[model samples]
Target chain A: MRIGCGAGFSADRLDPAVDLARDGALDALVFECVGERTLAFGHRDRRADPQAGYNTLLQTRLRAVWPLTAASGCRIVTNMGAANPMAAGRAAIAVARECGLRGQSVAVVLGDDVTSLIDADTPLPLSGCNVGDVGRDMIGANAYIGADAILPALETDAGLVIGGRLADPSMFLALLRHRFGWDAADWPLLGAGTLTGHLMECGAQITGGYFADPGHKDVPDLAFVGYPIAEVRADGTVTITKLPQAGGMVTTATVKEQLLYEVHDPARYLTPDVSADFSGVQLTDHGGDRVGLRGASGTTRPETLKVTVAFDGGLLAEAEVSYAGRGAADRARLAAEIASTRLQRVHGVTEDLRTDLIGVRSLHAHADHGLPVAETDVRLRVAGRFESRERAEAVLWEVESLLCSGPAGGGGFRGRITPSIVTHDAFLPRGDVPTRIEVLTA
Target chain B: MSQTQTLPLRAIAHARAGDKGNTSNISLWVNDPAHFAAVREQVTADAVKRHFGAQVQGTVTRHEVPHLHGLNFVLTAALDGGVNGSLNLDGHGKSWSFILLDMQVKVETGTL
Candidate 1:
């Protein structure tokens, strides 16, 4: 069976998956969207509009990939559901109908929401603070579930599976398990399957999306980069490659880079399905864009399910002004110090206030190969977080004041203040977060 | 006759960096299998820590994937409180691998 990745994230390019569906001969196309913070933002959007919680690009992605998938019989699985899978399922049907695919079966995987399961006063594992502390300030609580939550949907002949906070790998793994009838208890096979999913979860990352480095690791024609396809067998071996006419190159280096992406422990990479072990994993070049994966092992699944609690972290505001010509570095630094001092004294905002000269030193806080004696241009930026938008705006206000009150020849000023989502990650026992799946046809 | 040359880690290896919370993991892979030994030896956790200097506050743990010819360095407290909490524009520290790959290393001159 073959599975192809469409969009790695909600904001990823939508055109590549269309190419995958058109030329790659895929049995399924999985789009893994919805990051932890993204769900929080989705929750906030849902509160304002009843039908507005799904990924912003859901319609565009569905329109672009669904018609092709519908024609070719390639099933769709995605976590674009964000805070509301049911609504997203409806949205998927709407997109299908709009795209002239009227008979698409969309499934909504349920039971990931566990807000009611947790006591309001229960302290989150990461923050050690109760949800009640945030009260209405809390945006959303989503439990990270795995493939089992998605399996029933795939089994129901649903052409599309929409999930909220489903573990990214689970979407692809469910397709493999459902197709091959791989028993959930088969730990090694599950591990290999999960490894395959991990390698492809980031879409083109494994296929040279993020691997290109000029002369060091050159990827050809990245503008039209090809999405990855994994050919899987019943016993759990996978040959990962892309379309023959695609742009990117698949090599051992690309596979190795992606294998360790976001991985904390190689021996104990935990997902809801299995504890995937990549320590002993092997990658061999099969030549011609095919890389074979083996040696990945798995133990039992984790006892608990991880949950990310996103709360209103108030607002973060940033303001910047640039300076150039001759004494630019010194002017920018002076402007930053003065702006920060004035903001603290006048606006009484100091704790979270941070000032940095962009061209002089911002990325590396420690690595100052000694301050530039004479920079042609520099941007001085001041940012701060506050409990209220008014207070946050005060920092920006003070920085803007520097336009007239301080600095020499500083121009190109910009300021922004926006609501911030602070995430607190926690885990609950599996028994408490029982997952259920349901199918909806368009 | 073979000789040694000091060059950036990128000369012999390439790396990719990923972050979780405040910890950053950088996987460095050698261009050739023969140089895996040199990467395993010279690219010590201490050396990585020093290379990053004060950027990495917590400890560095190295994992060796010999079959794949790769070295994974887990750097703690490196992301400045990470995505949700960092003030840096690159809160995810996605490009940190390039910095690590730029670390100077002494390798056999003929390896390149």
Candidate 2:
């Protein structure tokens, strides 16, 4: 069976995915979205509008690809439900009607949410930070669910499966297990499948989307980069390839790069389903765009599941202005100094205050600090995080007011203040977080 | 045909970077499998730590993938506080591979 990746994350480009669904014949199309911050923002959105917690791009993505998925009879699976899968499922059915699909089944997988299970008394695993620290600022909490939680939805023959907070790879792994009827005890097979899911979970990462470097590793037509497709056999052996006529090229270089993407210990890559070992894996170019994977094994799943607790982290403000032409570097530094001095005078010396001269020393600020640079143009930026929005706005206020007051040639001033949601990742025993699935037919 | 020369690691390898919380993982792939021994000898964890200097806050662990002709360097405390809390514009450090690939190495002429 073949499974195609549509959208990797919540805000993935939708058009190319349509190309994957329409052109690539597939049994399922999975969209792995709903990250930690996305769910936190989703919680805020839900509080603002009780019915608006799902992915904001869900409708646009579904509307674009549902027609093709319906025509191909390819099932849809996604974690775009974020904080609200039921609402997202209903919205998918609504889009199905708009796409002229009849008698389709949409399912919502439940029981991933553990917000109520976690309290101030709960101990946060993996870090010294305690759950009590989140206190009243806690916005949402979710456990990473797995393939077992998603299998029941597939049993109902649901055309669309919407889930919330499942592990990114689980969406693709569930489709593989259900299609191949792999046993839960099939450690090696499950390991191989998990590896496939991990490689495909990020969508275009394995398909030459992220592997391009101009002169050295050139990829053709990256503007229309294609999504990946995995051909999984019953034995769990898989060959990954993209659309034959797609814009990108799939090589061993691209495959190996993604093989270790987001992976910590190559021998013990943990997901909810199984502990996958990819240290001994090999990638073979089978001619054409297909790259074959071998030597993946799995052990028993982790006893504890990771839980991400999202909290209201107050406000983050940033402001920037560009300085160009003669003595631009000096002028940019002067602008930064003025903004920094003014901000300190008004807001006091805070550890959160960050000043950077883009194009001179931004990313590696400490290493590049005090290093002289001669640039024709540079952007001076000031950013900070504050406990209160009132204080956060001071950062932008100091930089924006610099156009006429500070530097001789600062232009294109821009500033913004937004509420920030920081996450504290912890873990609870798998038994403490039970997962189940609920199906809803259209 | 094996004259000694100094060149950037990018001449013989390419790399990609990914972040997990505060720790950053960079996998360097050798363009030619024959140069795997050279990469293994030169690109030690201590060398990587020194190269990063103050940018890396914790220890560096190297995992060798001989089958793929690759070396995975997991650098701890490299991303400040990662995406959730880092103030840097490139919080995820997605382009850090370029920085890593820029590290120079001594190699035989025409080996790359």
Candidate 3:
């Protein structure tokens, strides 16, 4: 069986997916689009507008690839449904109709949303507090559903299968399981399939998109890096490669980097389908942008499903001003001090405010180990989180005031305010969240 | 003893960092197998914890993949509240891999 990755994340490039559908001759194209925060925002979108919870790019992506996949008989499996699979299903059908594609069906996998099941008393493991203790407005919760939830959808043999919070790798694993007729209890085979899924789920990551570093680890034609494709046998051994005409190389380095991407433990990588073990996985370089992998095994699936509970985290306000020419570092530092003092002393706001010198030290400054070097250019950024919009606006006002009131030669002031969402992990008994599948024809 | 020189880990390895909630995991792969032993010996959990300093709030655990000449460091409470809550622009800590790679290690002469 052959499979290709259409998307790695919710905001992935569309042209690459279109290229895969046109030339890949793939049996299935998996688009793993949902992330923890995207799902939370999806919930927020749904609350505001019922039809807006799905991927904002769902229609555009479908319009681009659905016709090509329909012509080639390559099925699509995706979590583009985000927080609302039913709405996403209808949207897909609409795209199919617009494309003049007939006899195409879409299967919607449901039951990942468990917002109604949770309450104020529900315990959150990561925050170490009850839901009520979060002291914020609750958005919603979604369990990370796996292959079992998606398997039935695949059984319908629909051209497209849509779901919400479907585990990233499960979309690929479900297609492989359906094609190979692999048993759910078969740990080793499931592990091998899961390994294949994990490798391909990130799309271009395994194909050298994120692996490029100039003068060190160089990737060819990185500007047009292609998504990944996998060829699997019944025994679960697989070779990962990309389209020949496309850019990016498939080597052991790229594969190894992706093998442990976001994976905490190689001995026991947990998923709802199985506890996959990538510890003993081996890679074989097949030359010409092809790498082979084998020996991934698993034990059992987790007893409980992991759910991401999202909350309205109020507003994040940010403001920045630039300082250049000689003594820029010192000027930026003084500006940061002024902004900090004014926000705290004058404004009487008491939220944790962060001051960053963009050019001199920002990301690593929190460690407090690096010394500031003399630089001609520096940008001072003041940021803070506030429960009220009025207080959040103070952060921007104080930083903007630095132009004339605090620092000399400061210019290029920019400010922004955005709604923020906080997510926490909670587990629910697998039995409580049963899945249902519905198929709609286009 | 054979001649050796201290060099940055980036000279011999490449790394990528990922995050889960408050935890951050960085996978470091040595470019040459000959330098894996030296990297494994020097890049211990405690060494990593000290290297990161206040950036990491919780314990650091390193998982070794000897067959692949790789080490996975899982740092807990490292993101300062992760993506949604953190004020840092790079809240995902995507650049943390370079921070790990910046650590210096002693390597055998002419191993590059």
Q: Per-residue lDDT tens digits of candidate 3, residues A104-218?
A: 9999999999999999999997788989999988899999999999999988869999999999988888888898899999988999999999999888999998888888799
Give the runs in model 2 whose Cα sits over 4 Å from its true position. A134-136, A349-351, A366-374
Tens-place lDDT digits, model 2, residues A50-129: 88889999999888888888788899899999998878888888888878877887889888778888778777654575
lDDT for model 1, please: 0.85
Better of 1 and 3 by lDDT: 3
Query: What count of clashes does model 1 give?
Result: 0
Alpha-carbon runs more than 4 Å astray in model 3 = A366-374
* Displacement of the residue A67 alpha carbon in candidate 2, Å: 2.5
Best by lDDT: 3
lDDT (0-100) at residue A65 of candidate 2?
86
A350-432, model 1: which lDDT tens digit per residue? 56777787877777766633333447778888887788677787877777888888877978889998787777777898888
i-RMS for every candidate? 1.6, 2.1, 1.3
- The clash tally of candidate 2 reads 0
